[model samples]
Target: MSTPNDNPVPTVRVLPETLHRAAAEVFGGAYLIGPVTDQMWERSLPMYRASLVQGIVEDDGVVGGVARSWEVELDVPGGRVPAAAVSSVGVRADRRRRGYLRALMQAQLQTTRDNGALVAVLRATEASIYSRFGYGVASTYATLKVTRRRAVLRPGAAAERRLKMITPEAAVRELPAVYERIRTARPGTVSRPSWWWAGMVDRHLHKDRPVWVLCTVDDDDQVDGFLLYTVNNRDGWDDPQQAVVEVLDLRAVDERVELALWQAAFGIDLSEHLLAHGRPLDPVLDLALVDPRAAVTTDVEDETWLRLLDVPAALSARSYGAGEPVVIGVDDQLMPDNSGRYRVSTDGVQRTDAEAELHCEVGELAAVYLGGTSFTQLAAAGRVRGSSEVLARADALFGTPRLPWSGTYY
Candidate 1:
């Protein structure tokens, strides 16, 4: 009978510059996204080639499993820190059950930490695959639906909003600056790179459907916010009567500006329905409507899976809510440097030698890292090991004024 020690470790290697497309090819098939064409690879090279790429190589010198990440600045509670925006993670169909996935994840994480990134984040295609790798659901989003005809703003709901319509090319030129100004409003926001902007506009420009960018300008003629969307017929091209307006992206300097943009969406001439995909679970949109029931939330799920590479550095970067200090212990199997006791309070976080009043694995700790979940909630599911008093203190210390939202989808 074979035992766990019978098998040998799979070889994982960093792909040379010429073999980067092999990583993309494996990922394309593993995800079943689309064909790995030269055009697509060229579009993607700007994002990851300058960084690093790793994979498991087969006997023929082709990649069987691949993982790669891009660099970005992550907005924490009080400030922004460097983060690895991971993507293109996949393994070939024949490579399943041989520890390729585990090897790729471990190597990538070690490389991220060694390269000085404190945190890493990714949007998972499968929920169960990442937790064992110390990745947790740090943010969640929902698809918000609104019947356009039924969405009527309350009196004085939308202020004197000044807006302008622009072509896709103009939006590509202007909206990144707008996003930069408003991204600080949320804790989990990330900066979009030039590649992100270029890809976005190119896709919209080449499509048959029309895309519009509506911007709200302030009294001084400064661009305060914008919404990018396209109108589509849900039933079919023949049934143009059922027009659905899909908002791909929206950002605002404040709630008033955001509310005005929603109002404009409702005002689009001939749309029957409006859908805002991957939005934070905020009631502001519902409240602005006269009935508050006009907007319904659907498909609420994980938005970003966050993993800490340098736990102490990640913890010290974010600000916490008001609470007394509490000692929390984390046992990280993958990254031993992250295994320690951390004392946290409104003042700051510090490494402590005191006895831990609460205990959890590194993944479990990350689940509450952005205040997206609470210790009391996790304790109910037996994920948190702590008394009621200590659990409450920990929750208070990690809480944020608003839920963390990573608006950018990689």
Candidate 2:
């Protein structure tokens, strides 16, 4: 094991292979695993970027590392724009608190900016760690635990569509169209490339051989939505009645199809409970349930963390609501170029020489950029500093008609 003081100022390098190995090591340490294999590394390489991979070397060995900026389009408030999805961030167990993580993050942010990505987004391993790096919770997800016995569709709910149970192979071939149709409908969603589909989506689907893929088709026989799940049978186990139908992935174009999918999951025989994890904040299931409490939302968590690398481009990409212009001062310590006063309005965004009505960090701005949280909420938390009138105006301008949701996890 390496000690922190062995190499006080660790050397940083961009080594894709070394970073990949070090990442596996960091993850093994993080998850209490002894080691990770090359096969695992090969499987995840589709999402890996050699240029974006950064590592800290000690005595010619990678001691800490991070990978990021997977080129992808993110659905912002009214439009889709280029974004860099940061992931696979980790540090060696023995290299903690040595500023390696901070150095890597700083380098990553600069690389993300240089890549011309308007925004930097991540699914944080630890919520507390990213906030200091100027990443704020940009989207939220809800976990649903529904009691199967009480999970009944509302009387007037739309009749079930043409649902077909297809093989995982078919699902891998067919579901991308359905996903593409709905990916941009919500803010914070990022496009899933073919590589992502194979490496992440298909890999998971193939893991559980008995996995069920239910596709919903329109009258014209066009695929609109799909549900990927598996059932646990505990016939000989102690709690025979405790079988669960777990939802691995569920996507639909509209509520009707979504309800149909939920009904199918609930209607699974011998399953006493239906659990859906990482669902959007919208309570479509709760509203469809005969007993609202049947689909109990056990937890809600931050799903997307966003950092503005280029404030001007980030602000300009998303459309704002109809409101008077407001000049807001942004303080971005990590990327000082993003620190400036910007006048935002429904018309557009631009750097302003005028006095600022509000002041906030880049993270705070990102928190409200997607319209998931309002300026008032951030102001209440002391994140946004402004007068009452300015806050109200900023809220109106930045707010969205629908809540921003990132349905896809990269």
Candidate 3:
């Protein structure tokens, strides 16, 4: 193990087979999972080989830390822009708090910038760790639980759409196009590369447990939505009647199609309750149900954490609301190049030397970049320093028509 005095610098390189195994071991140890097998490593190696993997090596030539990033196109206000999706971040237990995390993050940001990605996004394992690195909560998700007794669909719900249960193989072949249609129109959604699809398929097709996929088709014989879910037999031998239906993934082209899918999910026979995690905050099921309270939101939490690597590039890529230009000062300690005054309006954005009406850290700005939160709320929390007039102007400039949500997890 490397001591605090050893302080080794992290490097990005083609990991050798031994180091790859060591990295996997460290990751499993950190997460308290079983030992990673050779079979598992070989199966996932192709995906990792395609990503940007970095690690900190000790003087004894053992891997103590690892992080990875993949390229993705994130949907912004006006259009989609290139983004870096970060994942698999971990450090060996023995090597914690020796500045390794800080170094790894700095290197990751610089590498992401070099790849010309405007922003960096991740599903943080801990909410408190990434803010110091200039990342902020950009989107939120809700956990839903609804009793089967109260799952009746409201009158006039879409009944014309045809629903069919399909094999997972069929779903893998047909669902991407349908998902793309919905993802393009939604803010905060990101492109799921082929490797991501493979991983999802592998996860659901585990030998011990299997998942089912259902599709909804329009009259024209085209699929408009898909839902992947699994059923759990809660009561073993005593009461076999109790079961739960858990939704793993769901996507639809429109509300009508979404309602059809939810109707099917709630209609699963013998299931006492329907549970879904990481669903959109504003779900259509809430309005589609006869009793709106049936689909209760048990928890709401941050989904996507965003970091603006290139502030100018990120700010200018998205279109603003119709409002007067606001001169805001952004304090980016990690990236000094981003520390400046920016004039943002519905027209465009430009760096200026003019006095700033509002001042905030880069992370605070990222929190509102997707329009999921408002500047007024941040000001009330002392996150943004400005007057009421400027706060309202900032809020108006960043407001979005729909609540921002990222349904995909990396």
Candidate 4:
């Protein structure tokens, strides 16, 4: 028989409900996002309980690492598929280099796959860690800073007398219905569960700093668009001009409604500048400004990192553009069942005997899967191998009318 020191083994298991708190402590401690004490966890209990967790339990019964996921649906090009919203993943501080994280991730992937999720999506705390697990930077967003003094709305930008201010409590009650109706299900977007509204929005507005909400009403008295923002007062109360208005969440049913909401924001008196985080790569603010240069993009970063759990199901779920069919070979090391050449056509995707014209690893495939990046770009970067003709065909097949964007944050 081998001794304990011969070669240690790490194992991950589907933790029962009682260990949820233990797993959450490990996750929160790893990210330094929580003191995760008994009281704090109880206050945020509903949201914590929303996810199914897999953990590495140590011999002493302290959870060492965890991978937690929520059941969500991620929109693809022209369709949506069941998705695992992977979040709160972490390894204990003392558990470094013990292979606990790897085991937890592998177990989470398999468990999520077996549970019928076709894809997994996450917002990475560290940019470099998840790629090795076949997660790719699938969608990106930019932080936009608009100079309020220089910003002017053109004629017809807003419906006169349509903007209305509402209390935070009202926002919690009403905005979820508005969001469900207005959200167009763009590729990379995920459905917001009830817990999302409660935790991400309601709890913050009620428990944290003062937040403001504005709504635009239509002739039918329906809320067509809304903006959620917070004000950062300048150094001194006398220096209101230097204050900054930060847009937290804004959604509109259409372009006109969007511009109307921004127009109202320009009317705020305390701030000379406004910053909107997680704005799409192409924001209407750039064009909505009278002087387009007044709205500047400060930085662009990855918004969603995606992993294909069931490649065939994911490939078939999204609608494709008109292009000649191409056999693309995808190699997934973590989920070997996803490795195969798939014939992609407007009709659908299917495993095929035909030799692949384009070849890429699962990470590269995930990058182009959502139609945000073109095959040609990845080919030029050497992540994709294909002839010019095949690349062009793949690009056309995956092209979307609007770029993929996920407006919500976990």
Candidate 5:
């Protein structure tokens, strides 16, 4: 067994010019890293200013690893929220299997905790990692490949809305309200922080990018929905003449607005297909595409992995679907205080007890927190055990009705 201090203590430092050079070498040089252009840095200045890039250098002054955060949008229960997204996490190839990554994660998570960040999120390149560090998958997004011939949207009670074409300039003001409405209707969404609307768009979309926005207005002339998207002519070589609309984000206040936005997307000239990155599980996209099948295709996994820093606080935050009593045994390596048997009751109450009904390691417990994974699945995989009845009960209680998803990447 090794300890945090057993290995040579790597020096952690802030971003200095020399460190940037090291970062390039660690990520791009050896890692075949995609270079971060100056423009990209200029755009990320908002998050960068608020963020701290930490690194560990070997005694010889070679950078072994680096970690940093990117500005992210939160999908609160009712609105689009903002969060400090974690990204650019990597270690030098030569340093594979070393503890550098772990050290960087600990230091970074400590910083996040100190900042009182609501949550830290990311899109994992390797799914196997991060769980050990307490991050859980909060949401999953997908790029659906639909056959336009099969799409369907029978307008719900919400009246058909009139569509309007608005530029990104107008979007800055109108899209926020639409996002607010859309997020409110969806579950597992986080609210965007104040700074996001006031600032941050400049970081994702600048004056040079060809990104465009279309707003959907209602009968009252109020902006009810909007879509930020671009075209893929280069990738459409086979269908150069066909219309392909790639959606960045589409949000509406009401079903009508949502339907209208769909219509608006289909209105794009030469667009035969629609490609969206964050379409919720049951979206109204089918209503407009020529082939509804062309609309719903790919299922994507997003959101950062979650770990229970404080089990009680984490467990009690969300409501359990099943109104049953459950005994959970948890084993924690990082914080032994979190290791124990906990009584989680219906109606979202929990307490630690001397004895528990079922026991498992902390990592397995963490997997099911936030409804990212399921206990039944864990048991099926031989990770946790109980009678079949108990397994089903735990699954019902811990499982999210719809899949649990967090859209923002930290």
Candidate 6:
């Protein structure tokens, strides 16, 4: 395609998988097929086939920039929100000065809105890059490491727990129920699709690496919890036997089931240390192990980036933590009215009246929505403009003592 400037806003058309691979390579080596193997292709193929909106800014038939969006169902404060995950964002080094990324984001966000999505998300390669595009940090995940010698198992009058070594096929049949039961009670958790569950069992557990699963059941023979993990033998290292609990998908409602699940993991004598990724802060692991202090907690960085497509509806979906009335002005570059002032009550009811106290842009609101970054922090960074008192009042309105965390990636 040719244009007046000769740069021709380049025909942004979707390419085949082969061309997509070539484009991914030209864009960068990190996004190659290594992380995405053929086995896992089924999991994401729908994103490419049904959900993907990919394009390239071509310069005389040569690729200059690339952008793609993965439509996803996200768990928000209100409920399951239709959303899109804008990922694999890349621009040719030569195309940096041009507005490629901005153009791509605008097109994708608009497309997502048109498709009835309420939000958009991504794990930003650089934190500062996405905010200007109206994306905000909405959630975080963590990886915690604890030494087997130090994990303090809180001894309480729980029940006698048993660990059963299960096959990947067995795990596939057993785990979803436990996970489904757990997410229903949890506020920030999202429902895992059947594809995700299938991937976990078939590819992860039954692969060449030979991952194992431990099922935890109480004396009544009820399956309440399970741990999907791998054990590594690190010879000559400070901690030799390392058990990395990649996904401790436990759903124990009672102390017995909880303790039994931990016992199942703790009973694995092959590893001297235990580490977990995507675990909630208040993990049942806190009750397992010898001296819990040995567990190293590094804030794992992953967030659900949010852009409010519908301001009033999104604002009214979830109730606030407290009952203080504050006026919030949302700066929405995409949706103008979302920028106006509205009174947010502690009970979760919102109104556009004369009494609105805290106000900021939609991006700032997105950053603070997950509770990882506070309104005060954004104000300090000059991302949100306002007085100290206004920022404080806003913080009081949105800040929660326990930060919101997400365990899944869209």
Give residue 398's error in model 4 in angstroms.
0.7
Among all windows of ten consecutive residues in candidate 6, which has the lowest summed lDDT?
Answer: 26-35
Residue 124 error, candidate 2, Å? 1.4
RMSD to native for every prediction?
2.2, 3.1, 2.5, 2.3, 4.4, 4.5
Q: What residue pairs are clashing in model 4?
A: none
Runs in model 1 deviating more than 4 A are 1-7, 204-207, 234-241
Which has the higher lDDT value, candidate number 4 or candidate number 5? Answer: 4
- Evaluated at residue 398, the lDDT of candidate 4 is 89
**lDDT tens readout by residue for model 4, 1-410:** 22244435577888888888887788778988776777667756776677888888878888888888989988899888999998888888987776676777888889999999998999998898998999988899989898888988777765554778898777877888888888876898888877677666655655555688999888888898999988776453467666888898888888778888888888878788889999899887677677998888978999999999999999999999998999999999999999999999999999999999999999888998899899999999989999999999999998887778898898
Per residue, candidate 1 scores C-alpha lDDT tens digits across 191-292 of 998778877767765666678889998898888889999877645445435778889888888887888999888888676778898999874787788977
User: What TM-score fits each model?
Assistant: 0.94, 0.91, 0.94, 0.95, 0.79, 0.78
Name the runs in model 6 displaced over 4 angstroms.
1-47, 57-73, 91-97, 157-162, 172-174, 184-187, 199-207, 218-222, 233-260, 281-290, 299-302, 349-356, 385-393
Better of 3 and 4 by lDDT: 4
Give me the overall lDDT of model 1: 0.85
Reference-based lDDT, residue 121, model 6: 71
What is the per-residue lDDT of model 6 for residues 1-410, given as tens digits with 9 covering 90 to 100?
43334544544565667566445544453344344446455555544454354557364656666666655555554456666666667777656645666666767777777777667777676677887877777767677776655554667634576667788777777677767765533334555655556655555444554667776665777666667776554342444554344444555665466666665555555567666776666555554545656666777665666677666766666556554566776778776766787776666645576744556788878777645677788878888776778777667666665556666644
* C-alpha positional error of residue 402 in candidate 6 after TM-score superposition, expressed in Å: 3.8
| Candidate 5 ranges beyond 4 A from true positions | 1-7, 11-37, 57-63, 70-84, 117-119, 148-152, 155-159, 169-182, 185-187, 191-209, 234-243, 254-256, 282-294
lDDT of each structure? Answer: 0.85, 0.79, 0.84, 0.85, 0.62, 0.63
For residue 287, give model 5's deviation from the true position in Å.
Answer: 9.6
The candidate 1 region of ten consecutive residues with least summed lDDT is 1-10
Instruction: Please report the TM-score between candidate 6 and the true structure.
Output: 0.78
